[model samples]
Target: MVWRQHRIIRLNIVVLLYLMVCFVLCPVSAMTVSSPAEVHSVRGNAVTLTCTFTSTSRATSRMSVDWSYRPQTGGPPQAFFHFSSLAFPPQDGQFNGRVKWLGSPARGEASIQLLNASLSDNGTYTCSVRNPPDVHGSPTSQTVLTVTPKVPTVRFSDVAVLLAFILLPSAIITLALLGRMCCPPRDKSQTQGYHSPIEVTPGDEPGFKQINRKEKNMTCCDLYFLVWPFFFFCS
Candidate 1:
């Protein structure tokens, strides 16, 4: 019984080794494609349709890539790009002289560029890569691109309207401030005249000596000298 069990174990080991060798020799059929779900672009500009892929084996001359489009308005998909060992951009129809390849096959890229994108270019784009012998996982992916018209710029009329509503009021306020700073209004109290009543008494007057014929005969200077002393004494 021991001998029989030993033989059975050896046979099982041999079978496992054979299966491992077969798996190593055969090629795997697995691949994956990657792409953005959506893209946005302004009209009359360039846009890129990004795409990438992975495979169990490296790409070769036999590998192929194709890009197609479906209008946003709804329609059947149409081919606009092709690639094998070399790129084949579209040269007919709406895509004429507009499509360009911007991918590196050595890095497993299959992206493309569209020049002068327009409103008509807004649609769904599909990228398909087939690295033969790797055909298991999904090899195709899609992205939707939207092209919007450029917005209108500010016009002279718009600027005038803004000035009328915003700058005009601002100017008026500034002018009023400057007027206050440069030419302030006068105060009423400072400009008006004011007066107060005065009181006079007869006691302030000096007792004048009655002028006789002797004083009348005196000169003007002699009379002024006599009156000056009396004026000082009265004050």
Candidate 2:
């Protein structure tokens, strides 16, 4: 009989535990929050942290979202952003004026953009959401935000401009010199050198003079001796 009583007590305990889970833990576990496991961003650039939630209930005015941050050194999380109908961004902290709300809670989003991210901002961020009757479940999600120093990069356009301004002119000049050397032009001096000497008659000779029509009476040799010899003797 004692053993039977012990069995009855055990059964009662089991039922009580089951009831507790259904009444207390089930509703709290209904809403689920999610976010990226890790994020990478360059310093001085904007980085977005996204958080979303699914609830068994529909959207309501009471729905709210909160975002917090924790340093890499590990400490208590600090709330920096809050949203319901209006957004309450970080006012005065490491993130002052740098955090902007980018989420629409009605669409199950709780994302925020961190402007001018810095190395000091390298840490973990947590997002929590609550919607009236659906406020329980996994209402919080955490993301590890990693801010890396911006590395200088060379752009394709800049490289193209460098090549165009420097290498292109060099290539054009090289091609012009090669063309001039390979196919020489036909100059008048080369062709004229191969021709015979110009033909010269007695009249064309500088020292020989022909008799004019008016002096046809003179013989050709007499005219030549009189005109050409006299001209040379006077000089």
Candidate 3:
């Protein structure tokens, strides 16, 4: 029983020493940072890279945050941003004038926005956070960002609305105007006058009246003579 007690106490002591050594190695921070595994963005647009962390100790102005990037083509990581009480943006390379820091160390937030992203911007981004006098724990996190081409915005509904409100009405009105110009309506009085062959004054000429009476009497006499032959044959 006495031997077992001594061994247990020794084991606890060794564990405490190991933790102490790990704490001493990175006294400035004992933080864990995490980010999404994947992020998507459109070409010529912007995307947010989120990195949140928790410190084992209280937050302070001395806290520092760093961001680095590695391309999909595979190469050494490039440091682009740093925040040690104040922001230190990237000075050179493709990220120059394109990255904006969006972190508040006191709140345990360390994020950034990449503006005007291009196809070449597809890569892995890493975030590291440090706060003083704490045992370090998982101080780095990574996120993979993918940039895709923008899709066309024209839709079937948009075309339908344009035709309904603009094109269709314009076409109807144009056809109506053209028909009116090509074949105009005519007045009834003008059409009746144009069809008549001659204009006669009824009571203006006695010779015309005499000719009418003579023609009427000759028509009766010719009819009587034509029926007399048929009557004689029957008798």
For model 3, how does the per-residue alpha-carbon lDDT over 10-119 read when each residue is reduced to its tens digit? 99999999999987885564568899999999999989999999876777887888999999999999999999988899889999999998987778899999999999
Taking the tens digit of each residue's C-alpha lDDT, what string does model 2 give over 1-235? 9999999999999999999989886654378999999999999999999898888777777888999899988999999898988998877988899988888766788899999999999899999998877745688999999999999999999988977788667655654665555435645563333432376553454323322332354444554455455434532
TM-scores, each model vs. reference: 0.58, 0.59, 0.60
> What is candidate 3's CA lDDT for residue 22?
88
Evaluate all candidate structures by whole-model CA lDDT and list the values in order: 0.82, 0.79, 0.81
Q: After superposition on all CA atoms, how large is the RMSD of candidate 1?
A: 22.2
Q: Which is the winner by lDDT between candidate 1 and candidate 3?
A: 1
133: Cα error in model 3, Å: 2.7
Every model: Cα RMSD to truth: 22.2, 19.8, 20.6
Per-candidate clashes come to 0, 1, 4
Using lDDT as the measure, the top candidate is 1
- The Cα error of candidate 2 at residue 35, in Å, is 1.0
Ranking by lDDT: 1, 3, 2
